[model samples]
Target chain A: AQSVTQLDSQVPVFEEAPVELRCNYSSSVSVYLFWYVQYPNQGLQLLLKYLSGSTLVKGINGFEAEFNKSQTSFHLRKPSVHISDTAEYFCAVTLSISSGSARQLTFGSGTQLTVLP
Target chain B: DVKVTQSSRYLVKRTGEKVFLECVQDMDHENMFWYRQDPGLGLRLIYFSYDVKMKEKGDIPEGYSVSREKKERFSLILESASTNQTSMYLCASSRGTSGAKRNEQFFGPGTRLTVL
Candidate 1:
């Protein structure tokens, strides 16, 4: 079984300031990580994913995250945020095992980012 | 671009009414999913179909059923609408991922259903 945890429920930051959204996961086997953003009344859009190799992953809209294996965390970071960056962000995990693998994605509760000017 | 389309933007139904939510994907993806979004809870999967007539129950499938008679379409059924069932329904699709293929799911605009 796999589960995702997003520590922060809401994050408020002034425009042009940096922000970090924390995520953690627990799984018995190797996993794939993903981040998604949802605007008002719209479906989620894929931000980025960490499949293998490089731990540091870059995503759209000047956002990036680092996958820390030791901590079991995949935190999303933005050097600076814009008013348009205010939205709900989610962290998801899928087990990538061979043979009888579950392709289903388990998602976090969500973090609401509010960028105020 | 991958496009996922839902049958309605909004719907209103009475209690005990049977409801159907239709979803179609144009990307020829092999897997389709139905999820419901609630405040602070994110999205909870109701059902998913990996191929035509193939279905799998997700984390929350108690109040819902699904149908996938064709490759490109998936339908979510609510046997009896209730107030708790009123939420934003989302449809998503992705190419079947196997052996390290990283396929991201594409989502629809969403259907907000109100059950009275």
Candidate 2:
């Protein structure tokens, strides 16, 4: 089984400031990592994914995440944030290719990013 | 762009009534999913179908049922609408099998259902 933990429930940052949202996971096998963002009254949109190679993966909206195997973490980072970035972010994980089931993604509780101007 | 469409944007239902939420995808994806979103709890999966007439229970499937009569359409059924069932329901579809590179699920706009 795979589970995800997003350590922070909420993060407040001033506009144009850097922000980091922490995420960790526990899985017996290799896993795929993903980040999703949800705007008010809207569905989730994929921010980025880490399938293979490149520990640092860049995503849309100038966001990026680093996949750290030793730390069992995939933390999302943005050099500068905007008011439009205020939304809910989720971290998710699924078992790697070796797992035949094409394991369903398990998501964290989510972190609400509030960009203060 | 891959589009996933839900039948209703908002619905109001009385207690004990049967509620149905429909979702359709134009991409002809092989897998479809249903989830409910609540405050603080995020999105919880109710059911998913990998193929026509095939379904699987997700994390929270106790109060709901699902149907996949065709490849592009999936429906979520509420046996008895209750106050607790009032929530934002989201539907998603993916293009390929579970482990494939196209595993990213494309989501619909969502439907807000209220049980009175």
Candidate 3:
């Protein structure tokens, strides 16, 4: 089984400032990582994913994440953030092996990102 | 433009009452899932189905049952609603293929269920 741990439960950052949301995972096998964002009263939407290839993966809204194999981390970062970026972000992972169907994702507890004016 | 729709946006149920949450996807997706989202707990899968008439239990399936009579629709049933089950329930669907791009799951707006 795989597990995800998001180190911070809440992150408050000023608008136009940089922010980073930490995520770490534990898995015996190679895994695929994902970041999802959920706005108020809405379901989650995919932010970005890291399947295989370059460690640094860019996503929508000028967000990016780096997959560090040695550290078992895929922390999400944004050089500059806007007020619209305030939302609950979740980190998830699934095994890389071929599953017969869509593999189940194990998610982190989540981090609430609040952009301060 | 994958769209996943749930039957309700908000639902109120009394304790001990039967509850059903329906989900439908129009993109002919092969897999459907039911998950509950609570504060501090990102999302916990209750059940998932890969094909019609086939269902599998997920991590937290103790208080839920699922039905998949058709490939496009999936339902989560709570035989007796409890206060503990009050949360945001989300439905998702994904392609049942063997590639990285196809692994993305599209989610519905979610149903906020409150058990009184």
TM-score of chain A of 2: 0.96
For every candidate, what is the interface RMSD in angstroms? 1.7, 2.1, 1.5
- State each model's CA lDDT, in order: 0.92, 0.90, 0.92
**If both were scored by DockQ, which would come out higher, candidate 2 or candidate 3?**
3
Poorly placed runs, candidate 2 (over 4 Å) = A98-103
**lDDT score of residue B53 within candidate 1:** 98
State how far residue A82 of model 1 sits from its true place (Å).
0.4
List TM-scores for all candidates, in order. 0.97, 0.96, 0.97
Ranking by TM-score: 3, 1, 2
Q: Local error of candidate 3 at B89, Å?
A: 0.5
Say which prediction, candidate 1 or candidate 3, comes out ahead on lDDT. 3
Steric clash count of candidate 1 = 0
Q: Compose the digit string of candidate 2's lDDT tens values, residues A1-117.
A: 778889999999999999999999999888889999999888889999999999999999999999999999999999999999999999988787643245467789899999999
B1-116: candidate 1 lDDT, tens digit per residue: 98999999999999999999999999889889999999889889999888899999988999899999999999999999999999999999988656555346889999999999
Candidate whose lDDT is highest = 3
DockQ for model 1 equals: 0.70
